[model samples]
Target chain A: DAGVTQSPTHLIKTRGQQVTLRCSPISGHKSVSWYQQVLGQGPQFIFQYYEKEERGRGNFPDRFSARQFPNYSSELNVNALLLGDSALYLCASSSDSSGNTIYFGEGSWLTVV
Target chain B: AQSVTQPDIHITVSEGASLELRCNYSYGATPYLFWYVQSPGQGLQLLLKYFSGDTLVQGIKGFEAEFKRSQSSFNLRKPSVHWSDAAEYFCAVYAPWGGYNKLIFGAGTRLAVHP
Candidate 1:
């Protein structure tokens, strides 16, 4: 079975630019969550979508948003990006709503210069 | 607020030696705990988890973790370490309350295996 897959493994953009990262969850998984991992830090929760609805959100500003499609795929969008936005964007998926045993994707590395 | 803490920022151990990584969590109630390992440029992989029942949980790649409720700690242990085991380890916790409960992760501990 294919694991969680993310698109544009690495991306670079200038400040004030917008970026959209894509993620496809594992087969048969319904929950997709986004996380941000800066250098020398652990992953921090961003947004979570399940059944095409926003389930939870982290402390991120309104500039960050995400959505899930009917196919269980997810996209994370960041607007007015700042240099601090440069970090590894990780996507995780779980089979149920319990949030147990989440599987992660290789992550999309976003670099804002 | 819920939080997870990994006391050690980095740990270095010789190959074939034993390994232990500490994790502590702060929450109002019983929380679901987990350990994940991330190799360089790779996604985080589930090492083990603790929900309820037995305190000892076994995970993939010969890894195990024990959950101590009193100490609010879940520490990962391996009988012997391999060079390939060198990676960043994360400790995370999930609350059981309603709504979209997200996992709170620690700062992570980097492991270096020396041959």
Candidate 2:
């Protein structure tokens, strides 16, 4: 089975532009989470969606938002991008919202100038 | 607030030598622990996890981690190091937030292997 897959493997945007990253969870998975990994640091949680419902959110700004589709795919949106937002955005999926082991995607690299 | 810590920022080891990477987490009660490996410009791969029972747990790629509750540490170890094992290792704890759980990771320890 394919692991979690993310789209737009890489992209660049202006400081005030907006970007959206997509992720498709593994077959049969129902939980999807987003994380941002800045260079030289560990990943920080952004948002989590389970069963098409918003389950949790991280310390990220209001500009960061996400939603899950009926098929368990998810999209992460960042508005008014900042240079500080240049990092790898990772999408993880699990069996459910009960804290199962999460599988991560290759991540979408976003660079803001 | 919950946090994870990896004291060593970087480590160097010779091929065929033993290796151990330390991890410490700050949390009350026993927390779920995990170790993940990532290659350059790659996503994280789960090495191992510890939930309950047996302090010693084995994972993929000849990796093993022992969970020590007294010290609040989950250290990853490998008896024989391979050059391919050179990568960044992160320690993470499953933490509760809002109404669900999420992973909190450490800064990561980068391993460089000498051939």
* lDDT, model 2, position B54: 97
- lDDT score, candidate 1: 0.93
User: What lDDT tens digits, residue by residue, belong to model 2 across residues A1-113?
Assistant: 99999999999999999999999999999999999999999999999899999999999899999999999999999999999999999999999877788899999999999
Worst 10 residues of 2 chain B by lDDT: B93-102
CA shift of B83, model 2, Å: 0.6
* Candidate 1 local lDDT, B1-115, one digit each (tens): 7889999999999999999999999998889999999999888999999999999999999999999999999999999999999999999998743466898999999999999
How is the predicted docking of candidate 1 categorized under the CAPRI scheme? Answer: medium
**TM-score (0 to 1) of chain B, per candidate?**
0.96, 0.97
User: Under CAPRI classification, how is model 2 graded?
Assistant: high
Query: What is the lDDT for A93 in model 1?
Result: 95
Residue B86 C-alpha lDDT in model 1: 99
Q: Which candidate has the top score in DockQ?
A: 2
lDDT minimum window of 10 residues, candidate 2 chain A? A96-105
Report clash pairs, candidate 2. none
Candidate 1 reference-contact recovery: 0.85
- What is each candidate's DockQ, to 2 decimals? 0.77, 0.87
Question: What TM-scores do the predictions have?
Answer: 0.97, 0.98
